[model samples]
Target: MEKKKVLLLGGAGFIGLNITKFLSENRDYTITVADNFSRGKKDEYLIKLLENPAISMIEGDFTVPATYDQLEKDYDYVYMLASVVGVNNTLEIPHEIIRINTALIYNTLEWLKASFVKKVLFTSTSECYAGTIDAFGYKVPTPETIPLTIEDIGHPRFTYAVTKMLGESGFLNYSRKCGFECTIVRYHNVFGPRMGFKHVIPHLAQRFLANETPFLVYGHDQTRSFCYITDAVEGTVLAMENERSNGEIFHIGTMDEITIEELIREAGNFFGYKGEYENAPTYPGSVARRCPDITKAKNMLQFEPKINWKDGLKLTLGWYKAFFESGKESFEKAFEKPKANV
Candidate 1:
């Protein structure tokens, strides 16, 4: 059997690196990771991956139109996971997020239309489903079928969600008109090792480790379904391989929901630290509840989250502990002063 050729955009980030590792481990795929080093991994993992004969790396930015010209060569699949990430970062630079994400999708679709790519897997986000709940405070586990009509997006507002919504629409429309295979995975709060402290879990872990006082919580009553990184990688790979996923949108996350308070307490317990919680002023763009109805993923891709919340948090906290102990100057530098806003 011929090895499948894969070009993964943003392949150095948390989720992208995991996907690359999994695909390369099978020894049946030639993987090229194109990243701009915007959020590149440490040399340790990169060197390990480089040792695999099937894996290669390309340093480039996906937002540039010429970047697509470089990727004009044929590949069996293209995974567009590149985006301006971090909620605070997106809020701070909404224009950059919208431009890069939308441009990258358009460039990839154009390249695939002119090339021999078998499929394109575009990673979307659960944020796009914001404001779809009922007035009775009944929050439905959002299915892919829900309408994406919420459009009031901005700084501390709908920055990331709005950009991701546009990216999804661009891919769907291009795939339909240009006859390119496309799959969109709307991910919930995915947590794991190497995830930046911008996320809730890591942010809390860093603050607790630093023994910060009055640990701040935003929208403490809000609920979210946090998916482990491993589960997310499995679902993404399954979506890429499953033919039935073409032109379809699947919610790739754990269906189980937990409140912000419970999530913070779990992380605190993991670190053996007791910290008082104070509800912060609600940001302009925080949701009350977000969960996925992953029936489509399970039925079509045989995807189910294996890591529960407790076990996953334990594993993540363990990694952070080891990272702190390793005395790696870079890791220490990265964790310096927790950014409360993200």
Candidate 2:
């Protein structure tokens, strides 16, 4: 039998690279990783994976329609994981977030109109429903059915979610009309190594490594359910391959919710830091509590998250610790800071 042909639109990023790694390891798919390297180039782990010869790389600015032309017209599976993410960017450059993300979504949908992709997976985020939970007091461990709302539509932070909302509607409707299978997985707080320094875990690792005397735990009481990247990647692959997932939205995350204090204290323990803690204000527009109800994913796709938060957090802390000590600027920060700079 011929090898399965796969396309990953943003495969060089954190979750994308993990998905690519998992797919290439256990299957015989000829995978194409198309990334702008907006975050940065492939890391050592992803580079090592490329040596397997089943994977190939394509670099381009995917926000443009011409970028889609470089991709193969026919793919057995297409994972549309491209987007401008992170709260920093949303807060710093909401306009660019709107421009870039919207362009990427629209360009891809228009391209898919003529492409011969059999099935596609659109990666979404829990940010889509953050306002719903915060403003409406929606139940915790929110399910996929929660209505995505933004408290302030004009606010910069909500711009990211707005574009994601557009992508979700665009991909699902496009698939329905264009005759391609589609599935959506709204990720909760997925964290792991190579996730970049802008995220909470990496920042915490940095502070701990620096031995800050009075650790400032931002949003100390805010709660989230963190999912390990490996488990998230597995669930994503399952959603793409499972026949029952087409036209369905699943929450791919662990249901174990914990507070910021618990997370920080645990990381503090990992770094052997004995320090006082103080609660501090966090990013504006951030939700107070968030988690995913993954029962749909569990029952429909047998998606089970295996790594505990502390266990996964330790692994992530280790990677970020080494990276910071390397005296190297991360790819995302390097590219970001220069853009006036998000």
Candidate 3:
């Protein structure tokens, strides 16, 4: 009767923190959270989690190979969640995204080559198949089998997906050659509190809180299936722990697809804003429609999302509202709307 040891690289971020919280509450494991705090801040949420004696924190730039030295050579489970995320970061620093994300994947793979980690999970995104949908009209509720493509390799936005594609291939192949169990979970639109202000929900919350007279809905018709944080955490853990999931890729999201208009209007209702709504252009290279077919996860791992979109939406909006009402500033730069393309 021994406790399992868990290592969470970049575990201070939104989904990573949620995964840590879930494991700490429900599993009998000693968890180590390693992060550099570049994007994921040591905010109140993370600080509170560290109070649990079972959890420990390591702060270092994981993009550096030397930082991996600080981690133990043996781990019962390793969640490789480190990477540069968010469309804003992709747009602002595409080159840095390529550099840091590639380095993280390479360094971790090399480290695993010599380490004694039993199992590993790499978190990816739906953005990997966005090009297939946009360029070739791939089916909606896309599954893990779709070919990964980039419409414009030169576009800054697609840089994020390119690195994710690398991580997926790198982890799966590395696990086969290096003799470690590996699983991948491509997250759809997972959203919740502490998700940062750069995402759509938080941006909407901020706009409504400001009482904009006419709220603009960027890509009003574009569709996405949003998964709640807890649901995502459950699917991720299931993928990692389930014996059937090794070397398998699962789509960890709900099938509840809705339009951008629905999201914006619902967010407006939460803020009690009676404002005119206008449709506007979205970010460059933004996908027109994206959702994940989670049947593989459901059938193989019995993964199911519990929180519906509206309920999840309300919970997220409420958190953002409280955060703004407290007059607390965003640790990262608040997202600004770009001028609509003519």
Candidate 4:
């Protein structure tokens, strides 16, 4: 039997690299990770993983349509994880997000038309329906079928969501018309080791290590369900392999909804800091509460998230702690104040 050929479009990213590691380690998947390494150079984590003979890397700005020509025509599975994400990016460079993400989606779809890929899984986000839940009082544990809404279409923060909605519609419609299978997975707050510095978990870890007194907990009352990266990767692979999932959308997240206050103080506990915490305002256009109802995934993929938020938080906190202590500051440095003009 021939080994499966897999292409991870942004494979060098946090989640993408984890998926590559999982597949290359335990399975016979010859993997190719094409990423521009915008976050930074290939870290030791990715460098060690790519040491496997079955894995390879390609560096290019995939937003450029010409980049797709560098890829091979035949792949059993293609994981579309490439996107300009991060609240900071959306606020600072909303137009760029629109330009790059839309281009990536268009180019990938065009490439697929001329390629021989059997299946493509376009990764999505929970942000797409945040407005539906927060503004309209949709059920707490949101399902994939809930109508996706944008509270403030003019807000910069929503540019990411807008592009994601486009990808969902574009990929499914393309698969239908172009003769290929497509699956969509809207990730809740997926986090783990090496998830980059811009996310809340790592930022908290950095602050705790810095021993900031009166630590401010932004949006202390807001809630989110965070899925560990490993669990997320497993759910993604299952979505692709399970033939029953064709042309279907799955919410790939855990049911553990936690608050910003709890997550912050918990990190403080992990770092052995008994510092005081103060409530602070979260970013604009942020949803008040968000969690995914993954019933479809449970029923169809038998996907169960094993790592709880607390345990996952501990692991992530430790990694970030070690990372900051090692004098590596690029990730946190990237989380700068959003400027009025890009």
Candidate 5:
């Protein structure tokens, strides 16, 4: 049997990397991981994956049109996971976020118009509908049918969400006209090992390691549903492979909602921190609560998340602990203080 040709744009990142591994291990596909190594470096995990004859890597700044020339015209599957994410980047360099994310989405859409790709899965985030929850008080355990709203267009933090909204619209509309299948998956609080330091989990790991006394629980009341990486990858694959998913959007996350205080205390417990805890102001424009309704994904794709938040948290905290204890520094800028949880 011939293997399917699979292309993962920005496949070296946290979720993308795991998706690649999952496919390589379970499915018969010749995988090509295209990335610029901006955030997803040539890490040991990525390097090890590349050692597999079934997997290959392509390095390029995909924002440029010429980079698309490096790819084959025909592929059985294309996972468009490329984007500029993180609340830190949005707050610090909103313009760059717009530039890079817009360019990547637009270029990919144009390329897909002419390519012979069978199906494409565009990864999105729960941040896209955060404004709906904040402004309109949309129901918690939000469903994919909820309207996507931006509270403040001028706010720097919404820049990431804005670009994602563009990708969602662009891919869905383009697939209708361009003759390729497309599905969108909006991830909610997906966390696990190798998810980078800019997120909440890794930051908590770092602060606990520093032995900060009187630990501040930012957004102690804000609630979120954390989905483990493995479960997220499974949901994504099901979305792409399931025929009924075409032209449909799925919320790929868990429904287990917990408070920020609970999350922070869990991390504290993991590190054996016997110290005082205080409530502190979280980053600006952060959501008060977020949890995705996965009924659509469950019904259409039979998606089921097996890892509970507590177990997933332990796995993530353990990875960060080992990484930090090894005296290794992050290749990207260290997020010293807590920013808007992304």
Candidate 6:
């Protein structure tokens, strides 16, 4: 059989880059990455991927329909992983988050509808299920059946949730109306090597490594279901291959829950740092707890996370050490300052 072709929007980011690497290793897909480098360029990863004859790179914004059109030819799968990410950054620029996320979904769906793409996967976030965990608790995972009504998302952090909800709904609607396969993966806190340090894992890693004083903890009681990059990418690829996933949403994360305090302690342990954590003012739009119900994912796609929290933390710290030692100014910049609103 001929290899399938895949176009990955935002392919230069953490999750996208890992997905590209995983897919390329199979030597069974022609992968083209299109990224605007809004966060920063992954020139090193891009360069390494380019070494593979099957991979191609394109620099463009997902908000542009013409950009999608440029790479729309003869593709079996289209994955839209583009968005203004990081909780702080999203809250600081909610308007851009809403516009870019919505536009990317709309444009990608519109283009795929007109073209012959076989399957399109829209990367949504666990943020969409924000307050659901508050009601459901860790014992009860948030299932996809839960309605995404306004009442379910009654929090300021809902800006990201609401926009992502719109993106998922838009993709499903367009897929149904236009006759294309669509899959939605609501990712939780996916941490791993190459993850932007702006995120919790790498952020903590950097602080621990730097022996920074008064490590900051925002909303110490809040908890989240963390997923490793390998698990996230595996679940996503499985969703793409499983025909049952079309027009469905799956929570791609480990069901285990960890609090901010616990995460800080564990990360400190991973880095062998003994820094004291100080309580910081909670940012706007922060959720108290966010965990997913993976029953649907397991029953439907046989998806189970292989890496537990401790192991994942170790692997991430190793990556952070290498990243720090590489003396890449861009990597260092990732740890400079936290956004006011994350």
**Regions of model 5 farther than 4 Å from truth:** none
Tens digits of lDDT, candidate 2, 172-245: 99999997999999999889988876777877776777777788777788888899999999999999999999
Q: What is the lDDT of residue 320 in candidate 5?
A: 96
Candidate 2 ranges with C-alpha deviation above 4 Å: 334-342
Evaluated at residue 29, the lDDT of candidate 3 is 98
Model 5 local distance difference test score: 0.93
Model 6 root mean square deviation, Cα atoms: 2.7
Q: Which ten contiguous residues of candidate 5 have the minimum total lDDT? A: 333-342
Candidate lDDT values, in order: 0.78, 0.86, 0.90, 0.87, 0.93, 0.78
Best by lDDT: 5
* lDDT for each residue of candidate 6 in 154-174, tens digit (9 for 90 to 100): 444456777788888888888
Error of 6 at 159 (Å): 3.1
Colliding pairs, model 6: 88-342
Q: State each model's C-alpha RMSD to the native.
A: 2.5, 2.9, 1.8, 2.5, 0.9, 2.7
lDDT of 3 by residue, 32-125 (tens): 9999998888888889999999999999997889998999988999999999988777878999999999999999999999999999999998
Candidate 4 per-residue lDDT, tens place, 94-206, comes to 99999999999999999998888999999999989988987899998999889999988898988999999999999999999887899999999999998887778877876
The TM-scores, one per candidate, come to 0.91, 0.95, 0.97, 0.96, 0.98, 0.90
Clashing pairs in 2: none
What is the overall TM-score of model 4 with all chains considered together?
A: 0.96
Runs of candidate 3 with Cα error greater than 4 angstroms are 338-342
**Candidate rank order under lDDT:** 5, 3, 4, 2, 6, 1
What ranking of all candidate models by TM-score puts the best one first? 5, 3, 4, 2, 1, 6
The C-alpha stretches of model 1 lying farther than 4 A from their native spots are 134-138, 151-156, 329-342
